[model samples]
Target: MHEKKYLILYSTQEGQTYKIAQYMAQELGESHCNLINLHEAHTVDFGLYHTLIIGASIRYGRFNKKLYRFIDRHLAQLNAADAYFYSVNLTARKEGKDTPEGSVYIQTFLKKSPWKPKKIGVFAGALLYPRYSWFDRMMIQLIMRMTKGETDTSKEVEYTNWEKVTQFTKSIEKSL
Candidate 1:
């Protein structure tokens, strides 16, 4: 295969999506990859990249509105290339919910999105009490309580599976 150029664009609310994108870039070798915040990356020409990976975190039953707008704007370019999309949500932390089919948020987004990526991933997200604002912290705590999750405000839990992340990257690499 010829040398490939990749773009890893992410929209992060609490930073998990950005961290995932960073790791993907590292695994892909930074030399041929560019990492950009989706909100600020609208001006970049997507046609120039041979591979595109978009990562976004879901909150309040929705993927970031900014990311939706970006996808809408670049639907054709994204569909034209080898595009992959990953969604980070705490719901994926539960057993049997890590895959795209099992993730309700992923399913919802897929139904709503105009651009369907060739690859889809669903990863667990983080709960950083300190990082959240007062209202967010309270709301999240309530959610955790309702969901029978960790509600200790002082604790930080990251449910992401690093091994799964590695596997996903390898799958992308195989295609390239």
Candidate 2:
């Protein structure tokens, strides 16, 4: 029997979403899943894959505009397929804000688009101080302080919970 093909595509700014996509692809295995960055992929033949997992990182409380446009442009094909969408953001790492805020973000995006993915995930993002510009770094630091998140800007921090990500992926696999 031929193995089913899955496409894991993501849009990342500071590389956290990319890392999560990589982890999902790795866990799903290269033989069954092909991981691609939205920036690197010019065209996607939706009919060629059995399932598609689209991911995007949140910046300024919204998803990447490019990702939103891609989904909007390919809504028909994506809706016809076994599709899943995951949104990653710093708020998703917070104790009480992750699920609700993530849901709101997804719902707002879906309201503007036509496609409704079968599964949705909200994963925690990271704070890469080293990767941010001086202005962004200071702004994020201030936001973190306001939100009672990690205040020390001297070190890079990752707030993602790998176990939750793995469990979510496994659930999707089973459903498929």
Best by lDDT: 1
TM-score of 2: 0.93
Give the lowest summed-lDDT range of ten residues in model 2. 94-103
The digit string of per-residue lDDT tens for model 1 on 25-135 reads 888898989999998985978777889999999887788899889988888888788999999988788977889889888788888899898989889989999989999
Name the regions of candidate 1 deviating beyond 4 angstroms. Answer: none
TM-score of each prediction: 0.96, 0.93
Q: For candidate 1, give the lDDT of residue 129.
A: 93
Model 2: runs farther than 4 Å from truth? 100-102
The models' CA-based lDDT, in order, is 0.89, 0.84
Residue 128 of model 2 has an lDDT of: 88
